[model samples]
Target: MAQARCPLPSLLLVLVAVVLLVPRAAGYPWQVCGNTGSFTANSTYQANLALLAIALPKNISSSPDLFATTIVGAIPELVSALALCRGDANATTCSACLVTAFQDVQNVCSLDRSAAIYYDPCILYYSNDDSFLSSADNVASASTNRINLRNVTSDPARFNRLVGALVNATAEYAAYNSTRRYASGEADFDQEYPKVYSWAQCTPDLTPAQCRVCLAGIIAEMPRLFTDRVGGRVLGIRCSYRYEVFSFLNSPVMVQLAAESGNSGSPTPAMGPTSVTPSAAGGGEY
Candidate 1:
């Protein structure tokens, strides 16, 4: 018996459909889940999650801080969730980020009762418990690009110092001055290191003091964590900081922040050309 083979074009279309239908692997820079417990399928927890996942993103768009949270269902099956988009993200970008986040959280955490997913543009976290809202979790996590710096700078230590200064200043502004609890700016070292761009953010829910503590913790750990990497970010559930020689943020937003923070001298225009090679680093939680 001879079996008829499918046409090449038909086979190609079938393959494309299968690829599109497969749940994407986590695209987060880092993800962490709690070991507290797991929710049963077709249960109250899952149902509440279904609702919160849909509502939070929409709610965040109306807030000035681009942050939203919700508590759904009753005790024992309750799901508390939150989403925070990058401070510079517009409403459209924020919505899209959360949509992708909703899928990633479900795919990566699966049955975990508590989970946090960090993307370059947003952060999503959920749990059965409500403590996450007030706990001021200072736990820190880092994802560093393992690749060595491509163009070596003669005085690595000096360059590192300049980077630290830029990030530290931005962190301070984010914690104490920015109403949105976010700030970003650029530093130039007279073409020695070209342009160094940096951004820092803290969850708006935190008090200024708590935000400062969280930002300082991660900033202090950056040198040890990123080392010689050209670009990397240190993240905490409450705070995060990222920097590179290139710009990945909205220019107008960053310039406005710098002006308000009295750092208006920092360049707002794009400096030369730059590129970033997405890293395939794994997740870590502190």
Candidate 2:
């Protein structure tokens, strides 16, 4: 029974209900706020920053960068946004997701100088300063894109073993692969099904070691038992990890390249201890 085929949920149907009813419950999962407090910055400086971020995704929109600048906001924090469609999604679907994330985040965050938002479909974020290209913010957050799981849950230990194998392999690939700091692929687990489909990505500036550390930190969250579905993620300023039964992007190739150019080493600020944790049981999953 656990091995039965599970269909993909209607992202649109569920997302609409989730946004109207339980959006705040998400607690801004992909957030990295510096309680140090956000201060206002120069407007001219922030606009330039936003441009760099929007340019990363070529297929999303030709004039999104221009549209983003038009959205009136305070504080000139540098801004840059990224939207990566799932490897299996078509261009139209990816574009739609980007539009939704962009609009919703604008409403959700309002006028924050430095903020980023990630989605299962894509991500969009900007700050009044260009601090992102060279470094990631310790003030970010993320969560799993929910999906249904099969029989693995019947044996908690076996299910965890599968998640472990997938996340670990992806973490290794992400930390070491300089040409592309992102990796998503399958691995066998419990010798059943594909067992795992894991993904790992780091801010372009982070060193491979840092990416590994971040990925490993999240992978530790796989518990022997299951609750909802077989999906979770750890989003940090420097890197993040995602895993599910399905591939999340529409890229034609198995191993893909991040198209953005330039690799300046930006320093992500230190993530000070927060009472925060990743598990519902409590604490950052790491």
TM-score of each: 0.74, 0.53
lDDT of 2 by residue, 1-286 (tens): 4686535576677777877775442554243222222444455544454444344443454432111122323343334444444333455655676666555654555445545566654555555443444543333333333334554444444445445544565566555643345656554433344445566666544677766666655555544223324666655445667666555643322222111123322222122221211212211111
The per-residue C-alpha lDDT of model 2 at residue 242 equals 68
Tens-digit lDDT track of model 1 for 11-70: 999999998786433344556656569988888788889898889888988887888888
- Name the regions of candidate 1 deviating beyond 4 angstroms: 1-29, 139-152, 190-192, 253-286
lDDT (Cα atoms) of all candidates against the true structure: 0.67, 0.47
Residue 106 of model 1 has an lDDT of 80
Query: Which stretches in model 2 have alpha-carbon errors above 4 Å?
Result: 1-100, 128-151, 189-194, 224-229, 247-286
Model 2 weakest lDDT span, ten residues long: 277-286
